[model samples]
Target: MDFNLGTCFYILANYKGYRMSVEECEIELRDYDGEFLRRDVKTEGSIQPEHEVRENCKGCKRKIKLMDEGCVFGCCRVCCSGITKKISSFIGGKVRCCDVHNDRIIKKPTKSVKKPIKKEYVKRICIYKSLSQIIYTGHGADELLAGYGRHRTAYLKGGYKEVTKVLKNEVGRLWERNLGRDDRCISSGGKEARFIFLEDGFVEFIQSLDVTFIADFELGQGVGDKRILRRYAEELGLKECGNLVKRAMQFGSRIGKVVGGEKGDEEFEKSEKFKPPTTDPTKYDKDYRFDITLPDWLPYLQTHGYCVISSAVSSQNTNLALKSLITSLKLLHGNDVDTWDIPEHGLISETLGQSSGAWLIRGSSIVKSAFERIWEEKDLIVSMDCVIIWLSWLNNSNFKPRSEGLHLDQNPFNKLDMISVQGMIPLIDVTEEIGGLQIIPGSHVGVLKEEFKDMHGDMRGKGDWCQAKEEYVEGRGGEARLVECKAGDLILWDSRTVHGGKVGSLGGRREGVEDGEIARASVTVAMVPRAWASEEVLEERKEGFRIGATFNHSPHETGTSTGTVKGKLYEDYIPIELTAEQRELL
Candidate 1:
C-alpha cells in the first residue's frame, strides 16, 4: 500500500505487530509550528513494526522511545528543543514536554519505555477507567416491577388491583426501606453505585404504565414478573438473560443461610442490648405541689371528669399539716429516713391518718369550701376510712408506691347516683417533668364503661375496685392526660374516672443541701353528701373517727375501711381538734 507520513504514524502508533508492504510514500514530518522537519521522502518497503516506531536523535544519532519527551505529534525533542512555543501554537492543545539533556539520551530503545502524556489527558482517561469499577444495583426495580413472591401471592388473591396497590406502596417507601441502606453499604468501600431503575424519569415512566401491561401473572415465574422489561430485553438479544429466574440477593448469595439460618427457622428473640435499665421506684416516689391559676371548679370537673382547685388549703395550713405529718413520722419511725415504706396501695398507718397532723389537713376550711362548692351541698361527710398518704424520702432508693395502672375507686355494677369525689393535696409544685397524677378525661361519661365491658367480662357487682386494661387507656379517645398541681392545690376526680399515679425524677435541686431532701409528699381525701349515707354507714363513720380508723374512698359505705391499722402502732397518738364543719364529716 502507498501511504503518507501521517498514515504511517497512525499505523505505527495503533496497529502493533502488523507487517505491510509500502510500495511508494511521500514522507513529511513537521514541528507543531508547521516548520518542516522532513519533506517528500520516497520509500518502498515491506515494513514489519514490532511495537512503536522509534526515531533517531539528530544530535546523538541514538533511537528514542516514541513521544518519551512529551513531544508534540512525535517530533524529535533534542533537535527541536528551542521550538516549544511554535510547536505549542501549532498543536492547538496543551502540551508539556520534558527538558532535554545530552547525557540522558537513550542509546537503544527498550520495550519497557513509556510515553509522558499531558496530565489533563491522563485525568480524563482515569475518569473513564473509574466507570468500569462502578456497581449497578437492581434495587428499586423489584418494588416497581412486581418481582417478589409476595407480589405473586397478592396477584393470585386480588388480581391486578392488588398488585397495583402493593407496587404503589413499595415504590413509595423504596427510599426508606431499601435505597438508603443499599447506598450506604456500597459507598462504604470508597466505591459508588447507581440505581438505574430508580432514576426519577424512569420511575415515573414505569409508574405511568398500566399494571396489566407491566406484569402478567398468568405467564408464570420468570416471564410472569416484570413482563414488559423481559420482552424489551429479548428484543435487545438478551434472550438467556431475559429468561433467567428471579432470586433475592440474600438467597442468591446464600448470605441468609449463613447469617440467619433457614427462612422459617429464623430466631428473633429480643436483644439485651436494647433492654432498658431497671429504675429505682423509690427514686420517683416523692411528691410535688405547685400553685397555679384556678379554673371554674364545678363546670370544669363536670366536663373533664376531674379538675384542679388551686390553693384548696392555705399555704400556712399546708406547711403546718406537712410539719405535723413529719413530726408524727419522726415520732413513729425516727428522723433519719429513706422512705415511709408505706403499703404499695398507698394506704398509710391508720395511726398516722388519725394523728393531729392528718386532722389538721382534713379540717382545712379551704378544703371543705372546695368540696361544698363541688357537691353544691353544705352537709357533707368525709371518708374517714382511708387516709392515703404518698410520702417518699429524697434519697434515691427503689421503693415504688401505688400501682401505676389506671383503676376506678367505685364499682361500675352499682348505682351511678352517688356524687362522691376523690381529691389529692400536693405539698410542692407538681409539674410534667416531676410527674404526678394521670387521668383520662370524660372517661366517666358511660362510654368507658362499655369499652371496659367489651375488653373484660362483665363483672357487675363482682368487685368494688377494678384496674383498667392498658389497652383501654391507650386506645383511641382514651389517651390519659397528666394532672399537675402546686402545693395546697386540690385535685379532684369522679370516683368512676380512670386515673393513675406516675412517678417522676424530682429533676432540679441545689447542689449540696437539698440533694437528700424530700422528693415528693401528697395526701389523698374524698367526701360526699351526708344524705347519701344510710344510718348504719353513719354509725360506722362515727365509730371510725372515734377509734382513729382509716378507710378507702367511699363516704356512704360502712364496710370499706381497712379495719384497724395493722402494722407499727403509736399508743399515745393524740387527735387534732376539729371545727363544727369538720365535726359533721364524722
Candidate 2:
C-alpha cells in the first residue's frame, strides 16, 4: 500500500523538537508497528469460515456438495470438465455417470479448417503417412495372414478347417467391422481412408492359398495373425518388424492408458487444463511442410509412385532430343509447330513411337542416378517404344484422346509381374492450364498393381487389352492430376500407374499463331533394368544402333523402317563417352 501524502505530512508536522527532519519523521511513520500495521499483519481474521469451504465445486464453484468427493472436487458434469472426468475414469476410477457424463468418453464430431497438403522428403514422411494417411490397418491382415493371437489359439485346438472358418468370417465382415471407425480416425487428420490389405487382389491372393501353406500343424502352433505378411516382411529384410506382434491402436498410442489407478486424488488434482489424448508425434506439428530436394526423389518415387525432378537433364540435351525427333519426322524446323504435321498414313506417329535411341543423348548423371535408384541397379535398358512428342494443342482443334482417360502400360497380353516404369522429360513446361500427362497419386500401389493381379487369368485371351476396372476408373475419376513441370523437369511413374496424355485446349495455343499452335513438347523414355531384358533384345538394340534404324515403339507394335533414316548420325545422337555405370544401361 502506498503511504498517503496527507498522513505523511501530518506525521512530519507532529515531529516537534526532536532533531528529526520531515523526511526522517515520514520514514519513522512508515516503519512504525501501529494499529494499521498490526491489522495488515493479522492472519487469524483473513481465513474464511469453515462453512464457506464446503459450499461449491473447486473448479467452477457454482454447485453445492454435501461432503461428497466428486461433487466438491470436480466441477458439475457438463461442458467444461467432462474431458477431465473421462480421463480420470479411463485410468481406473469408477466413473459414476450423472445425467450429463457418460461411462465412456463420447467422440464428439468436431469441425476444423481444411488441412493443408503435406510435402516432405518422401521416405521420412512415408513412415508418418503410413501411420497417419491411408493406414495399412492390420484388420484384414490378421485373418488373411494369420496375424492374431486368437487365430493361433483356434488353430491349435481345431486345425486349418477352424482357421479357414475364422478367416472367412472375418474377411466377410471386413467392411462392417473396421471401415466406420477407421474412417473416423483417419478423417480427423484430413486424409481420406484407404486400406492396402483389404483390396480385392490381396484378398484373393490370401483366399487362393492352400490352408497347409498358411497354417500347418507341422509348421508349429497358434493362429498366425499376419503369417504371410510377416514372412514377406522377413524376406524384405524387416525381421524385427516381422516379429513385432500386433496390438490395438488405442493401447499402442496410449489412448487407453488409465491416469489414476493407484495414485488417488493427488493425481486428479495435478491435471489442470485437461489435456486431450493425441496420437500425432510431438517432434513435428501437423502443419509442418518439408522442402523437397534431390535426395528425396527415389523415396518419393517408391512411396508415392511418382516424382518430378527439375533440371534433371540440361536444356541443351533436352533440346537435342526434340531436334532428333524433328529430323526423324523430316520436319523443316524444330521451332515451328505448324511444320510438325502428321502424314496422311501416320508416318509421324510411327516415328514418335520408336524414337528411343534418340533420347539416350539426354541421359546425364542425375538421370542415371534416378534410374539406378528406381531399378536399384546400374544395368538399365532404354525402352524401345517411347520418345513421343505430343503436339497437344496442334491445328487449333481440341485434341480428344481416343483411349478412355487413364490407362496402365500393362495390358492383358503381358503378365502382371512384367511391369515397366517410364520417365517423361519435357522440352517445355507441362502445366495444368496447358494439358499434359495426368497421373493418379498413389495409384501404383492402391489400384494399379492390385487391379492387374486381379485381372490376370480372365484378361489373357479376351482380346480386350485395357484391363482397368470400372470401380477404379470411377473412384479415381477426379483424382487424375496433371503432371505439371518446367522445361527439363523429369516426371517418372510406375508402369502399372494409371496415367494418360491429357488433351490440351485451344487456349493453350500460341497468341501469334491462330492455327496449328502447339503449346507443350515432351520426350518420354521407357526404361527397365538391363537384367530384365534378354540377350536377343540387347542384340536387336545394338543392331538398331549400328544400322541407324528405329526399333519397335511398344510391346504391342512390330518394328518397321523408313528406308535409310535421315538425322544426326546414331553415334552423335547417343552418348559416346559414357561412365561405367552409364555403359551398363546402354
Candidate 3:
C-alpha cells in the first residue's frame, strides 16, 4: 500500500511472506462506439485492449440493442473502472429489452437515488475481513514534518526558532490532538493502526537532526516542508508523489464533501459556548448631560501637559458606554480578551473606534462640555477613535516595554501654533496597580517652545508620529508619571506630550467595572474646535460615518476608514443613529 499525506509520501513496497489475492466480479461497460457490453473478469488485474478482449469472446446469436450515449447501470463497474471510464459507460449492466424503437434500445430510467457514502471505512472493513489485520496509514507524518499552514506562518514570523517551538509543542501534544482520535477510528475495524513516522526510534532520530535538514521553510510551500522525506521519496523513484502539493487528508480524500462542507464549519463557529455575559444598561443611573463649564484644571493642563478631571463623565453614562463596547467585542472577537496580541499601547478594538456606540460617553453632554471648556469654544468636533480595553493581568508574567518607548502624537515641526488636545474617559477606575497612562510631565512645554528642535524631526510624514529619545526626556529633568483616576474621569493631554500606556499588574477587582472584569478600559475622546477642520476633512468624516470607519485622535485631520462594515462580523451589528450633536462632530 502507498499513501501521500500532506507533504510526506509513504510506501510499503515489499512484504516477503504475504501473497495478494484477486477476486472476480461481473462488470458492465459501453464500447467507444456506444454498444452495451458486459464482462466477468478479475477485479485486481488490468484490462487488456478492447480489440484483444473482444477476440476471445464468442459472438452472441440474440439481437443486441445499443444503449443511450450516457447512462450508467452497475455501481461496481462505475466505482472500479474510475471516473473517465464511468462517464463513457453511462448505462451499465446486461439489458433485457422486449421492444426496440427506431433501432435504439430504450428502457425507462429509474428514479435518481443518493446515499451517504463512507468509502474509506467500508474499504478498510473489507480489507480487514479478507486481506490483512494490519493497515498502514500516513497519519503522524504531518505533525512531525511541519506540513500545516500554521507552520509556514510561524516560520515566516520568527524563523526556525518559532517554527521549531511550534513543532515541539505539536509533537508533545500529538496524542490528545490526533493520535487518540485516529487510533479509535482506525481500530474500530478490528485492525491495528501502524504509524511508522511516530515510532519512538524514528521520532528520536528525527528530533536529533537539525530542524533545517528536516524542513527548509525558505524554499516555499510543498518543496520546503519535509525536505528530507521528499528527498527520500524522490530517491525511491516516486517523483510525482514527492512533488505533489500538500493537501489535508479530508480534502485529498474528498471526505469533506460528505461531511457537509463549509456550512458545517460555519455552524460550528456560531455554536461557541463561551458567550460573554451582557451588561445591563438599565441598571446604571443616567445623570449625565452636555455641559460646557471651564474647570480649574485648565492652568494645571497648561503647566503639567496633561490633566485628570475627576467624575467628568457620569457613572451611568460610563456603564452604558462600557456595555456597548463589550457587546461589540463579543460580536466581533468573541470577547476573548486573553488571546488578543496587545498592540504597542495595549489597544484593541481600535478598528471599531468610530462605531456610534464607542461615542456613547464621548458624545454625552458632560464629555462634550469638558472638551468645549478646554478649548473654550462651543463648536467642537469629536475625534473618531477606539476604546482601550487592557487586560494587564494576562501579560504581567512576561511584560516588557516597547523599545520605541515614549512618543509624541503631534509633529513639533509641523506647526508650533496648532494645538490638538487629546482626551480619554476611563469607563472604570484606574489605579497604579491596575495601570493607566504614563507620561513625562511638562514635555509639551519644551516641545511647543521648540527647545528640542535638534532632537528629532516630525516622523508623521514617514507614516509614524515623532518619538522623543529617552535621553532627551531625561535631559529635560522630566519624570514619567502614572496618572491614576476614578471611573468616568476625563484625562486630557496636549498632543506634544511624551506619553505611552504602562502595562498593569494583577490586583483586587475594582467597583463599577462591567467590561469582562477588564483591568483598564477607556474611550479615547478628543475634540478640536470646528473652525480648524476644512470642508474637505468634514466630507471625509461624513463618508467615514456612513461606512462605520475608525479614525485617530485628531478631529481636524483626515481619517482613514477601517472598512469594518464590510466584514462578516459587522453583519451582526445594529446600525447606530447619531444625535444632532454627534452629527456636528462628524
Candidate 4:
C-alpha cells in the first residue's frame, strides 16, 4: 500500500471517527475546504484558502478593526455591533442622563496658546439670512455600539426594539429646531445663522438593534426627569430654564424626516416668529418662542459682523466636547475631580467662532490697555441711560467692554469685552462645552411696582428689575423672557432690560472650574452714542464710540469712555443737568 497505489486516504481513515465510503469522504473533505474559504473571506480580499490575508475593517478601506485575541480579521472585528458589545462588557456603570453632563474641569496652560486676533475688516449683512439644518446619524456614534440607552429601554418596554431608528430620527429633529433658532436669531442680526442641512438615515437598512432605553422621558411633566437635567444644571448654575432637550434639535429638524415633515409647516407661517401662544408663557405655551429681535440700532451695529450669527447646529457634539474639556482640565489641576471652576466673567468664550456678541479683545497689550481705558471709564461719560436707549439703534453686536471684572486686567491680548441686551445672545458651540449668558427680555421699558418703585438707582441684576417682574412678567415667574444661549453666542439687550446669568450650566467651559459652575459668564461692554456725552467730551468719545467699529472692534460694543472727561466736561460746560422733569422728555 505504501509503494504501489496507496489511496490518498491511507490507513488512518478506518480509525477516524466517521467510517464512510471513499466517495462520501471526498465530498466531506470538499465541504471542509468550502467552510475554510468562507471563514477566511474577512481576512483576505478574496476567499481563497491559499492567499495571504491582512488585518483591517471589513467596511472601510484602511481603518483597522478592533480585534479579539483570536479574531484578527475585519469580518469579526470592525462592525459596530461587535464594538458595542466589547464596550458594554467593559463598562458596566450607570449613566444617569442623556441630556446633561457633569464633568468639572480646569484649563491647563497649553504649550502654545493662540490669542484671539483683532480683525482688520468688519462684514455687515442684513438680518434677513435664512437658516437651514443637516441631520446625520448621531446614533452611529451615539447609540449603535455602546450607547444603547434608549434602545435598551425600548427593549424593556414593549420588546419592539427600535433603538437605532428612534435615535436617528431624534437627531434629525434636533437639527431642524436648531436651524429654526439660528434662522430667527440671525435674521435679526444675532450671529446665529445657517446655510445648509445634511442628513444620514441609511441605518434603518441595517439590522435593527434592540436594547433597554436608559431614559424614561415624561417631558412637560413638571418635575420627573427635570431633576436629572437640573442636577447638571446645578453644577453649571443655569440661569434660564433647563431646556436640555435642545440637544436633539438637529436630529429633530433634519434627518429624522419626521422633523422634515414638521418643517414645511414651520416655514410656511412667517408671522409665527413673534406671535405669542394663545395660552400663557408659563404653561409650556409653545414649541420654542422664536422672538426674532430686530436690534433697535440696526444700521449702527451693521459695521461689524453684527448680522452674521452662525449656529454650529452640532449642539450634542459641542456639549460633549465641553464635558471632555472639563474632565481633562480637572485632572490637570490636581484638585477634587468633581469640583471645577467656570469663569463667570469673560463672555467672549460663549460663542465658538469669531462673530456676533463674542469678539476677541486680544492683540497688542497697548491696544488692550487702550480698550480698558474705555472699560473703566464708559459709564461715567455716557449716561448709562443714553447708552441703553441707543442700543436699539446701533448694530447691537458684541459690545465689548460691556462691563469690567477680575479678568479684565489679565487678558494678555487686547482687553477682552462682552455686551448683552434685555434679550439674550444664544450660541450653539461645536468646539467646547462652556456656554454663554442668559437674560430676561423686555425687563427694560417696564416700570417698577409699588414695592420696588423706591429702589431704582444702580444695580443691574436686582433692585427695581425684580419688582417689575413680580407684577408684570406673567408666567416667566416675573414679566420677563430668558435668553438661553449656547457658547460662541453674544447677547445684547436694552440696558434698562433686566438680565443675569443662571449659574454655569456648561461644565468644561471656564478654565478654572472642575465641574463648571458660576454666574452668567461674559466679557461684557456697553457702547453708548456720542450724543450721551457733553459736547466737549463728545469729540473725544466719538473717536472710540463710532470709529473703527468696522475693523478695530469686529464683534462690537467698543464704546468710548473717559472717566476724566466725564467730571471735567460736567465742570467746564456747566450744562443744566437733567432733573426728573427734564429726564422725562429724553
Each prediction's whole-model lDDT (CA): 0.58, 0.48, 0.56, 0.27
Model 1 lDDT tens row, 29-117: 11122222221223221122223444754233456655444332233554333233333444464323332322344333333323322
In model 4, state the lDDT of residue 546: 26
Clash number for each model? 18, 15, 9, 103
On TM-score, the stronger of 1 and 2 is: 1
Show model 4 residue runs off by greater than 4 Å.
Answer: 1-436, 446-451, 454-482, 505-521, 525-586
The regions of model 3 sitting more than 4 angstroms off are 1-295, 335-344, 349-351, 392-404, 447-451, 457-464, 473-478, 505-508, 511-516, 560-574
Residues 33-145 of candidate 2 have per-residue lDDT tens digits of 21111112234212111212344433344554432332212333432134333333333333333222434354431222122111110000000112233334455666676
Whole-model lDDT, model 3: 0.56
Candidate 1 positional error at 158, Å: 72
Q: Tell me, by lDDT, which candidate is best.
A: 1
RMSD of each: 32.2, 28.9, 24.3, 29.9
- Quote the positional error of residue 176 for candidate 1 in Å: 72
Best of the candidates, TM-score: 1
Q: Which ranking of candidates, highest lDDT first?
A: 1, 3, 2, 4
lDDT of 4 by residue, 218-279 (tens): 21111223234344455687735543323342232222221222343454554656675452
Arranged by TM-score, best first? 1, 3, 2, 4
